[model samples]
Target: MGADDKTQNNAEKLGGKVQEGLGKATGNKDMEAEGQKDQSKADLKNAGENIKDAFKGK
Candidate 1:
């Protein structure tokens, strides 16, 4: 994947982790779930980018 996309995805994943940690510390189930969802979305985007790169023989 391109550098910018990769960086953005990484940042998103990191932010999600922070959110999850905060939620756990504060006993907020909704925030934790949302954080997990954000991480999943970032992961999916990375997977899609990888697939595109593979198809392009990168």
Candidate 2:
């Protein structure tokens, strides 16, 4: 993956983690679910980037 893409994905994952933690602490199920969804999306994007890089032999 490109450096920018990696950084963005990491940031997204971190944000999601923070959101999830806050939701759990405050007993907000919706926030927790949203956080989980965000994390999942970031993960999927990361995976796609990895696959692309592998195919390109980078």
Candidate 3:
């Protein structure tokens, strides 16, 4: 994957983690769920990127 894509994915993951932490601390179920969703999306994106890279023989 490209460096920019990787960096953005990592940043998203980190932001999700922070959101999850804050949500838990504040007892907000919706925010926590949103954070979980965000993390899942980032994971999916990274997986897609990896598959693309593999197909490209990288």
Candidate 4:
């Protein structure tokens, strides 16, 4: 993936982590679930980028 996309995905993952921490601290199930979802989505995107990079021999 391009640098910008990678950066954005990383940022998203970090944000998700922070959100998850906050949710846990606040005892919010819904927020925790949402944060987990966000993290999963970012991970999926990063995996896709890794596959693309592998194909390109980067």
Best by TM-score: 2
Clashing pairs in 4: none
- The TM-score measured for candidate 2 stands at 0.93
Q: By the lDDT metric, which is better: model 1 or model 4? A: 4
- Report clash pairs, candidate 1: none
lDDT of 2 by residue, 1-58 (tens): 3879988998999999999999999999999999998899999989988998899899
Q: What is candidate 3's local distance difference test score?
A: 0.87
Q: Candidate 1 — number of clashing residue pairs?
A: 0
Flag regions of model 2 displaced more than 4 Å.
none
The lowest-lDDT stretch of 10 consecutive residues in candidate 4 is 1-10
lDDT of each: 0.88, 0.91, 0.87, 0.89
Could you give me the TM-score of model 1 versus the true structure? 0.92
Model 1, stretches more than 4 Å misplaced?
none
| Off by more than 4 A, model 3 | none
lDDT of 3 by residue, 1-58 (tens): 3667877998998899899989999999898888888888988888988888889889
Candidate 4 per-residue lDDT, tens place, 1-58, comes to: 3677888999999999989988999999888888899999999999988888889889
| CA shift of 15, model 4, Å | 0.6
